[model samples]
Target: PGVWDVAAKDNRGIMDVAVFRLSKKYPRANSVMTHNLPDGGHVRVASGPDGMASIWDYDIVLMGVSHLTEAMNRYRAGLGEKPGRSFRPHVSEILKFCRQSDGGRQYEAVEAALRRLKQTTVEIVRRQRGKDGRPLRVTEGAGLINDYKAVSHEDSGRVTSVEIELPKWLYAAVVEAEHPEVLTMHPNYFLMTPGLGRFVYRLARVAAGKGEARWSFRLIHERSGSPDAFKKSSAGIRELIKANELPEYDLAEEPGQDGPILVMRFRGSFPTPSTDTAGP
Candidate 1:
C-alpha cells in the first residue's frame, strides 16, 4: 500500500519498524499471493448473506499481525509474555500503528475494524512450499481471529486496551518463521483507499525481496480479487505509479502488446522508525 509514503504527510513516525516476515505473508490477502512466508496462507474469503466478501479489509488483520510480530520479537529478546494470547497489544499501540488516534471518530473506526476482524469468518488454510517450489496442497479452515475484547474508561470513555485470540492457523504461521524480521509498515496503510494499491503493497512487503519483482496486470488483478475489469485493473496500476503514492516500493509499468506488467522494486531496507513522537 502507499502507507509509508502517505504517512509522511501526517508526520507521525514514532511507530516500531516493521518488516515482511514469513508469518506476515499471506497468499494475496482474496483475500490470495505468496511470499517467503514459511507457509503462505491459502485464504478464501467467505461471502456474507449479502453475497459479497464480508465487509473485511485485510489491513486490520495485517495491523494486528504486525504488532504480534513486534511483540513476539520482543519475547525472543527476553521480554515477558503478556496475558491471554502469547502476544498482547495495547489499544493505543494498535491505534498508533493504524494511523488513528483516540478521537471519537477514529476510536469508533478502530472498534468497528476490530469487530469486523473478529466476526468475519474466512476459510484460511496455510501450506508450506515443497522443495521443488510447489505449494503442498492442503485444505483446512480457520477464522482469522478466534475472539477479542475491548475495554473503555467510563469517564473519559475511550478504548484503552484490546485483547485478541488467534486460531491455530494464525498462531502456527506466526511462529513458523525461522528468523522473523517483523516487517513494519507505514502507519498510513490503514488509510489507503480500499482497492488494488493496498493489496499491491501487501504483496510487495512479502514478495519483493531485497531486490525487485514483476507481475503481469492479470496476475495482480487475480491475486487482488478485484471486481474491476481487466482494462480497468491495468489502468489502475499506471495511475498508482503516476500518483507516487507507493513511496517505499519503486513501481513502474511495462507496457505489453497483450497488456501491461507491473515492476516493483524494494531496496529492502527502510528508515528506522523516527523518534519524533509529536503526533498520533
Candidate 2:
C-alpha cells in the first residue's frame, strides 16, 4: 500500500466515482499514479517531464466530447451531419473554450499540454463476469490521445490549428454509443484554479448531479489521488467547502460516524439568456 501507484488504503468502498480518470493534483514531476475503481477496474498512469495530465488537460477532452456530442445529436435530428471521433479546432478557439487568453505563452502551454497528454501512458485492467459466471479481465495500454496534428504559423512557428483524434474508448463512450454519458459543465469551470477545487467540482457534478450527496473526508482523500498527508489534504478540502466558490454547487461539512463528511448540493446552473431587448 506504500507504493506510489496504489492508494494508501482501500478506496474500492467509495460509492461515488467520476468517469474520467484524471489527476486531481497539480502537474508534478515525473511519476506514476494509480486509481482503483469501485467496480474493480484498475488504472495506472505513467507521466514524464510534462507530468501527468491533470484536470486542466481534461479541458481539451471535454471540448472534444462536447463537439462530438452536438454533432451526433444534430445527425440524430436529421441535420444531415456526420459526427466523427476526430475534430479540427483552431488553437484560438480552444483557448477561448478554456477561458484562457490568446498569447504566445498560452499557445506554448497548449502545446505542452498536448505533449503531456500524448506522452503519458495508461494501463487499465477491467474486471467483469463472463457469460459462464467466471471472472474475466481485459487489459489495455495506451495514451490519453490516439494522435494530435498541429498546424503552426510559418513566420513564428506558433501553433495555429490542431486536429485531435480521440481514443477508441472515449469515442465509443461519447459519440458512437447510443446514450452518451457526457455532462454539461459551467462556464466558470475554466476560471477556477488547478487542484482539489477543480476536482471536487467535478466530483460533485458526477456524484450529486442535481441533488445533495455526502462522502466522508477519508473517502475524498483517497479518491482525490492527493500526495499530501491526510490531515493536510483534509484541511485543504475543508477550506474549499467553506469557501464554496465552485460554480452551480454549494459545499458544506457535517459530522458523520467516520470523522467529518463533506456534503455537496446542487445550486442550479447559470441563468438562461433573455430575448428581451428593452432599452435602459
Candidate 3:
C-alpha cells in the first residue's frame, strides 16, 4: 500500500519515492542520502528542477536533549523539597564565605549598605516630588533667603538688584577675624559678602599707586586684647597707604574713635562729536 502511494507521486513527486525507499532499507538510520547508502542499495539518477537532496543526522540533537535532562535531574536533587530553589542558597553561601574570609571588614560592608540605602531613598523622594513640586531638603539648616528689588531707567524697563542680609553676628565675627585694622581706620565699617568682596579687591588692585588710593579692611569684636588684634588694624592701614601713600595718618585706640578715614573718588570725561553747520 505504501509503495503504491509512493509510485503515485501526487504533488510531492519523485522526492516521496526516494524518501520511502530510504526509510524501508534503513529503519534506524533516521536520515538518508545517496552517498551514505551501501553498494547495490544506493541509486543515482539525473537531477530534477528541484536539484539535489541532503540529509542531517540527529545524533547531536539527541545528545543535547540527554544533557539537558541530566542537568534538570541534578538541579531537582539539589533543591530537595523545592523544585528550582538554587538561587537563594547560592547567594547565601557566597555571603557567608565573604563574611568568614573578611570578618574585620564588616564595618566597610555596613557602610556600603547604608550608602546604597540612602541613594535609593533619595531617588524615591525625588520621584515623589516630580519637577513642579518643591524638592526634598537634604540638610538640617535653613537655606539662604533672597530679597530682590527692581529699579526703572529711561532706556531700560527694569534692572533688578538683590539685597542679602546674613546673620549680623556671624558677619561681624568673620570681619573681625579677617581684617582687624578696619576698626581703627574707620569708625563706620562694612563687611562685603564673599561675592562683593571679589569686586572690591579687584577695584583696590586697579587703584594701586593712584592718587590717594583707598582700601577697605574687615574687623571683628572677639580679638579685644590679643596679640593678633593689631593684624586686622594693620591690614586697614596698609590699604590706606596704597590709596595714596599718605605721609601722615592717625590711628584710634578704640573702634568708635574719630580717626583718619580712607576716601576713594572716581572721575571720568564724556565728549560728543559734532559737524560744522554752514549759514545761508
Candidate 4:
C-alpha cells in the first residue's frame, strides 16, 4: 500500500502482460493477442469491432482506477463514502485528467475508447490457493469494462457525462482486496510520446519500484505484445535506451546470456546517487 493522503498520479494493477497495443497505429481488425507467463499463467486479449485498444485508450482505465483507489483510501480512513464499481464523471473531468484537448474530436475519441473498452475481452488464467491450501487454477474472462452510458447535451449533442461499470476483477483488485497490487504512476506518464516508452515505464514502476530491476529484451518483447520480430524488437529497445526520455526511471542495456538485457534504475523526481548493480 502507498500513502493515501498525498496527491499523486494514477495507479494501475501490476499486470504481467500487455493487454493493449503498444503503438498508435490502428491494429489490424479481428486480431487476438496472447501471452504465456513464466509460471504458466496465461493472458488473452481479443479485439472488438473498433479494433484492438491502443495504449491511449488505457488512460480511461487509469482514471477509473485513480478515482476508486482514492475513494477506497478515504473510506478506510473512516470517511462516510465507499467506492463502487460504477463511476460517473463529467466528460470534461476525464479530458482534463488525461491532459487532452476539450473539443469535439477529443470527445469523440473518448466515446470510441469507451466503446472499445466495453467490447474487447481479456481472459486471464493463473494458479492460486483456496482456503484449504490446495492449488487451484482460477480463470477470469470479461471486457475491460462491463458497460457504459454517455449522456449528450441537448443542443450541442456532445457527451456531457458518462457512467462506467468497471469489470469485477478490476474493482475487486482495487477496492476489495486486502493489499491491492497497485502503484502510483508519474504525472508525466500521460505525456509520454513513444508507446513502448509508456509500457517500459509501467514495467519499471511495478518491477523495480525504488530499486533496480533487469529483464532480457526477449522477455520484454514477448510481454509487450509487439508485432515486430526479435531483431526489430531488440533494436527498438536499444533506441529507447538512447532516447532516455521516460520519466522517473533511467534505461540502460547490458550483455545477456540470450541477448541484450534492459536495466531499469529508479531515479526519483530529483537526482541522487546511482545504485546500479550487475547480474541476471
Order of quality (TM-score): 4, 2, 1, 3
Q: Kindly report which residue stretches of model 3 are placed more than 4 angstroms away from their true locations once superposed.
A: 1-230, 240-257, 268-280
* TM-scores for every predicted model: 0.67, 0.84, 0.15, 0.88
Among these predictions, the greatest lDDT belongs to 4
Query: What lDDT is obtained when candidate 2 is compared to the true structure?
Result: 0.69
Could you give candidate 2's per-residue lDDT for residues 1-280 as a string of tens digits? 1111110111111224322333444565577767787669876777778677766776777777666665665576677487777888888878887878999888878887888788777787789999999999989877777789988888997998888987777677666656555665667777988467877877787788789889888888777767778999788888897788998899999999879999999988544223111100
- Tens-digit lDDT string for candidate 4 (188-231): 88788788888898898778878899999999999899998999
How does candidate 3 fare on TM-score? 0.15
- By lDDT, the candidates rank as 4, 2, 1, 3
TM-score of 2: 0.84
Which 10 residues in a row give candidate 1 its minimum summed lDDT?
Answer: 11-20
RMSD for each of the candidates: 8.7, 8.9, 46.4, 5.7
Clashes of 4: 0
Candidate 1 residue lDDT tens string, 1-280: 1121212211011011111111222222323322222356445544222222222234445554544454454466666463134344666566565565557766655565555555445453557687899977666655556777778888876777766776665544544545433455555456776356666766666567457887778777665555558787778888888885763788988876667888888744554444222111
Ranked by TM-score, the better of candidates 2 and 4 is: 4
